[model samples]
Target: MTETFITIFLVFMILAAVVALEARELLSTVIAVGAVGFMLSVIFLFLRAPDIAIVQIVVEILTLVILVRATISRDTHFFEDEREFFPFAINIVMIMVFLIFAFWAVKTLPRFGLNFSKVAPYYLTKGLAQTGAANIVTSVILDYRAYDTLGEATVLFTAVLGAVALLRRKAKAAENKNG
Candidate 1:
């Protein structure tokens, strides 16, 4: 069951990523990116990492909300053609670079499902005892890695502030045009 879910979500993630990159419309790109994020969160859930999944979902929601706000405030008349003068050359180069990195990763990384750390055991065994959290994942994220969580929250707050500022600017510009 897990393997099937993993396979399906992985395929969706790859498709979403590709569509996100290739989409000509800004809204389509944003939707594709959100789809990718959702698939990734599901993948993380299938891997038994609910903490990461929750964080990914929250971040994805925040990002989609920002994108939606930005899009709604703008004129949505025509689809944008983002083609460049040398689009083919750039696309080829990017594909080659990605393939090289993919091959390198395949060669260097250990096989999937391998226990890559001794930390998991330690977290499971001593986490609740040390942190007083029943869930080991919670203990790891909230107790052992609280600083990382704080940093993420700070970044999200900053992003929200930026989005609000941009929306305000757009509203002011519209008011100036009408008034």
Candidate 2:
């Protein structure tokens, strides 16, 4: 039963990713991406990683909401005349290559054992002593690898600020012309 569930989840995830890539409408693509994330969360849940599943769902919701808002205010359809097939083809190829690499990496992961071969069990046991944090995830993110998290946060903030600045400039230009 568990195997069947996992197989179905994997199939759904693949289908969602393909649909997201092929979808021309921005809203439809965003919806497909959200579906992929939700399917991943289901897979995580099936694997007994409830914390990861919850985080996936929350991030998916945030992404979909942001995409929907952006789509509402901007043109959702691409100009067919200006579309270049080469870039699209290259993007598709790159996505497939990355997907293959990801699958290979997953297959190479070590199985869980009681001897603390992996980091999760070690963190769950000794993380409190090392980091003085009750939650292993919090300790791992904010203490053990805080620099990576800080870099990610900085990148996200920069991207958001750049986007807002560009949009505001366009809006102001239109307003000034009308005035």
What are the TM-scores, per candidate, against the unseen true structure?
A: 0.72, 0.65
lDDT tens per residue, model 2, 18-80: 898787788888899999999899988887778899999999999999998998789767524
Structure candidate 1, residue pairs in collision: none
lDDT of 1 by residue, 57-122 (tens): 999999999997797688753456666769878989999999999998898887778878888888
Scored against the true structure, residue 44 in model 1 reaches a CA lDDT of 92
Off by over 4 Å in 1: 80-82, 150-179
* Model 2 lDDT, residue 91, Cα: 89
Q: List the global CA lDDT of all models.
A: 0.86, 0.86
Question: How much is 29 displaced in model 2, in angstroms?
Answer: 3.0
